[model samples]
Target chain A: MSRLIIPLSAFFFFMAESTYADLFSGEHFNSSRIFVPHFLFIFILFLTIFGSTKYGIIYGFIFGFLFDVVYTEILGVYAFLFAFLALVVSRLMKLVHSNIFIAALISTAAIAALEILVYEANGLIKDTGMNFTEFATIRLLPTLLLNFAFIIILAFPIKRIIEKANFESD
Target chain B: MPQFFLNKRLIVLLVSIIILVALIGFSVREREKLSWPEQFLKDTTGFVQNIFHQPVQFVAGFVENVNDLQHTYQENKRLKTRLDEYVKLKTEVQELEKENVELRDILDKKESLRDFDPIQATIIARNPDMWHEKTIINRGKIHGVQKDMAVITSKGLIGKIKITTQFTSTVQLLSSMDPKNRISVGIYGKGTIYGFIEGFDQKERLLLMKKIPYDVKIKKGSEVVTSGLGGVFPRGLPVGKVEKVESDQYGLTQVAYVKPSAELYDLNHVIVVKRKISTTESSSGAGAEGDDL
Candidate 1:
């Protein structure tokens, strides 16, 4: 189970990086609709609940490091944020029944909101005066809607793969 | 009570093993060296990365193949007419070929040139966003391709090597769409006219010689060759030709329209000019004259 989870989580991270490149980095969209997909988020959440928190944090750090390298953003910022988010998401996993689609949608929306807040804060520090309201309505909102739509379509198949892999390991 | 199931001795043994490994790792890092174990791990990781990346490569290759098929269809239509022209010229070509052999012997007596170990590389991947940007060549450091090496096609100068590793290298094409690319150009049968070429817009086009002095007599059609002023590119290589010339406001300089000889969109075979490792004068000065393998 440990061996399978290690490689499987790495695969998920690589896949997410390759697909979400130039899409989720908040570079494409405005402040209103900056969003991220929740596949890795959900994976960390599921693993923390059913497997281990240490594994969750480890995988989160690795995933976020790769994200920082590819996205041309500050190092360790996303790593720390992802680790913190994974902990909170794991806690929420205890209350919700295992519905991957709903989990992915909720997580993506929350992460997107957090990302916008960070982006706005950075803008304020830099004195760029880039309007957050403009970005939120134009970029973040659209991305959130699009990501959720995609999650709804992909959740079933990805969830099945995760479950099958875990089951086979056992 | 939580840990009572495991033996204390076994726990101590595991902890001690981890401590020892940590000490070794710390020492290795402090020395800024890789231990045997670390080297093995690095090699293994690289091997795994190469294996996992096979699928990504396959997708890139498939895209290249589809793009090539489209280009082949276009070329086929043109080549059908060209084939008839070649047949008619065959008789003339034979007589010239014999004369060319005698001329070559005379030229050999006149001057000698150095030999190059040229290797042909196929471009594997290219960035779509930076359409006129750098491309990744399949040849890498292991393949005797070094940094600063010149890359050219049968037609003319393409670019040079910027970065290289064991399996791949990124080549900065001449038409990188960057303003920094100032090429020294000379119209055949005329004095060298130096001007910078750049990308005009999103149309995947070249903006050549935007502001040349209007006094310079440039015809509608003239071959532009590299001036070899830059240490990077060799002398007298075909870059492109003048298509149209327009005057800028005030008419201080003529904005000449130019098109590249090589169709970069459909580049297949490119030769990486391996600078002669030794100076034996074998096929030397090939860069200055007609293409010699």
Candidate 2:
């Protein structure tokens, strides 16, 4: 039962991502630009900060692969991005003390970095034809706001779960 | 401690980067087709998404319907007025359609205006990433959905099928400014002025129809529809209305910004049009170019 917690949580994240994806279709906004919520990444970042970096990377790789297969056209983009993000956040955690505030800040910055990296990589490959300023204003900003709200709502509960999972493993 | 020089993490990172690059390269080259593993994953995840999406969508629809209840009286009144006009126009259109068919039969024309079978599908999931502008529909290869087949709402054209699994397919929305996904469209007033819907202008929320002849006079509010010249999308599918026209950057041709009639963002149910152009008909039709009556 204890061992099942992590995988179950990962499944919850997947379900949450899809649920949020449906909820926030920008239907109320009536705008052309979309605001994609990276709820799964935020959950993985929580796992890295609280549980263990190695476990975080493992979860990141698995869930990111699932995300790529389901949401993206390319297979490796999200897998690489999520693992890289987990690795970066873990490294950054070494330099800074981890707390709800600092961890939230790090996660926000990491998500922004992830989105920018993806935007640039896609532009290089597919020539998505979106300029940087337009991307920043239309997609990146709204996405950050949406993820920040999720981080706030889920941060404490996720931190508690990760710590408990780590304790149980030990 | 030179043991630090043999960093295991660094080597793993380097190896993973190589693998990732190769994976991205392979996937990019094989964008049109999905590998079996990808298909399996997509189908499994699509099944999950369907389970999650349907209940949520039902609740959301219920809430929206409750919200719309206030406007129901006004909406019913307006719709009743439009229904009267629609009924009058329906008979006229039926008569014209029969006459047109008779005329086409007299001329021995094999192709009619709307010659495609439509597969109805409900959108199960949308990629929130925005950059992809993709929606996963419930129908796939089993339902005869193929790449490049047009997907439309009852209002207008929306997108085309990009990739398909056994039970699910991805639609590349017209709002996606992919250079390869250009749709051949024509303005349907006066003489037919043809152009390609090359890209979408995100700022203006309009599609950019480019390469129209400079001499062609495109009026604002003129209806734009698929010309069927590309042979992928059938003719007479409503695309949009021409919002504005401008001279090309080179001053050689005109470009029209079209506002698509379909509410692209809020798609629920869509029809996938499968064009069935026979090989013999195409081979014979190829010789008779510019003979459109």
Candidate 3:
């Protein structure tokens, strides 16, 4: 039953919950935006328990790659970074049995930071129109705010999901 | 011997930590190599998306219906008037069909246009970040939508098919503001204008076409269509119209702003061009990449 829920949630999160658009086009003033990444947050935790280190690594990779595939900015940079981030998050969670809220907040913040870093690095290497100072002020700051705000919203579900997994395991 | 055979919890913790470190190292070392596996994950996610989408779309349609009830009567009246116009148009079409058949009989030797085997699909998901980024459509390799095939709406160029699986395909929209959009656009009256189109900002949704030679006579409302230079898109599909033209500050070339004909935000359906892949094009790895599984 727990196995079924993880995959189902993973599927549902990617399919239904991730409906909001990212960056540049939408009005930035919508205060009621919910930052839940749905099954992705749960999926990360699921991978840590039942799957291998390889599964987490691939999860991170695909998380970022899917982002690039949909968004098409820095190519595979985000995909790679997400895969990397998931691996670390999974490891940390495995070590310390902490509150899911803090865990999710940290995970979201770390991934958001990593995403910004990759964007900066891509600009640096390619030397396109990306200005680091401008990116920080315009892009990263708002994104960080948005991502953390989302983390808070999703914390409840994260706790529920982790607890459910723990319950089933016990 | 007793020390070496430590606690089970410690062993699990140590093993988990080691796995974590290795995952970190692997992620950093080969970021570029992660595309294949990521593609696999996306494909699976897409399947899950398809199953869930039907119910979601049904609910959306229901909501739309409920919302439309307020305006439905008014819209119905308008549609009746439009339907009368369509009736007249249908009569005209019948006359034109007879004329077309006669013309076809006279001109017996028609060039074999490539068959466009299209699979009807729904737009399952769109990238939340970029409007012109990519769309995950509900048809894939099983439906014969190959990677690099051109996707278009009835209006104009949609984008190229980037990835495909058994049940879905992800498409990049032409509204990409990247510097790499070197599309061959043919203007009305004038033969051809070659330029790049990309996004500028949200407020003014304009595609900047770089470097129209200063000497060319391009007015405010010239029609632009794909020239089919690379055969990605068919010849003479309506791309957009020229918005404005100005000489570059550097004096090397002039630039024209093109307003895309397709209203991408409201897009519900799109047609994928199913041109035959040449032997050489198929051999080069485009064939193997976008499998749904």
Candidate 4:
């Protein structure tokens, strides 16, 4: 039962993200600009800061690969992005104190950085045909706000679960 | 072993970077055709998404139905009025269609308009990453769904299939602002004026129809439909209505902003149109000249 906790949690997180994505797939609030909630990344970030970075990176790789396979045209884009972001967040955690507010702030910054990386990577391969300003205003800002709200709502419960899992593993 | 030469973190970083670059390169090349492992993963995950999506969609649809109940009376009245007009128009359309078919038979035309079979599919999932603007439908190669086949809702044209796995396929929406997915369209009015829908304007929520001949008299609200000049999409499928038309910056050609007839935001069931192979071959020969523009 204890061993099943981590994998089950990760599976649930994956299901949650995909379900939410299906529910709010298209335009939101009748606005043309889309807001994609990075729920899975937020959970992975919580694990990295609170449970163990190594485990977080592993989960990131597995789930990111799944996301690539399920949702994206090209494979490895999300897998690579999520794992790389986990690494960055884990390293940053060592330098900064692990407080809820600070962690939320760090996660927001990390997600913003990740979004920019994805935008650049897509532009390199596919020529997204969107300029920097349009991307920043239309895509980046809304995504940040939506994810930040998600982090605030789920941060406490997620941190509690990771802490419990860490204690049990010990 | 020399400690300096065998630094663990440095070695890890180097290996991961190399792996990342290789992964990106591999995926870019494999975007169109998936290997066996990729296909296996896509099929399994697509199955799971379908499992999760169906239940949620049922609940969402139930709630929407409840909300719609209040307006049912008004909607019923409106539809009833339209039904009368529709019955009259239906006979007229059938008569005209029969006549058109007879004329084509006499002329020995090999291909007529609407020369394709539509495979119906429900949208299972949509990419959360908005930049991709892709939706996954529960139809694939097994169901005769292939890449570049046009997808449409009952109202109008929506998109084309971008990639297909065993059980699912990705649809690249018309709103995707990608230049490579341009659809050739023509305005249906007093005269036939053709152009290409190059990209979408998110701000105005309109499709940009570019490179129209400057002298063509395109009026606002004229119906725009596929010209059949594009080998992939059949001709006469309604695309949108022209909202505005203006000359290009260079003044060489005209550009029209079109409001897509399909409600792109609310997609559920869609039809994937598979063009007949012989027609595609024939059309490609004739459309080769127009395709250059």
Each model's fraction of native contacts: 0.00, 0.60, 0.19, 0.52
Specify the poorest-scoring 10-residue window by lDDT in model 1 chain A. A21-30
Per-chain TM-score of chain A in candidate 1 equals 0.68
Question: Pairs clashing in candidate 4?
Answer: none
Error of 2 at B15 (Å): 1.9
Which number leads on lDDT? 2
Residue ranges of candidate 1 with Cα displaced over 4 Å: A5-155, A160-170, B1-77, B87-116, B122-135, B152-158, B173-192, B198-200, B203-225, B235-270, B275-293
The full ranking of all candidates by DockQ, starting with the best, is: 2, 4, 3, 1
Q: Is candidate 1 or candidate 2 better by lDDT?
A: 2
Tens-place lDDT digits, model 4, residues B178-288: 767788888877778989998888777899999999888888999999977676788888899999999999999999999999977657899998776344554455643
Worst 10 residues of 1 chain B by lDDT: B27-36
Question: Best to worst by lDDT, what's the order?
Answer: 2, 4, 3, 1
Steric clashes per prediction: 18, 0, 13, 0
Writing each residue's lDDT as its tens digit, candidate 3 over B1-293 gives 25434698468547654754454445433132235655576677677666666676676678768988999899999998899889999999999979877787899934322335566667777765432357788787778877667677888776767667666787777665444434555675745666545444333455666657777878788877665544454556677878888777897888888787875553557888765423234345554322210
Q: Could you tell me which residue pairs clash in candidate 2?
A: none
- State the displacement of the C-alpha of residue B118, model 1, in Å, after optimal TM-score superposition: 2.4
The sequence of per-residue lDDT tens digits that candidate 1 reaches over residues A13-57 is 545433343123333332322344445555555454445556666
Model 3, runs deviating above 4 Å = A3-8, A22-80, A83-108, A124-146, A167-170, B1-43, B66-109, B112-117, B128-132, B177-180, B190-203, B275-293
Q: Compute the lDDT of residue B108 as modeled in candidate 3.
A: 92
What lDDT score is found at residue B25 in candidate 4? 81
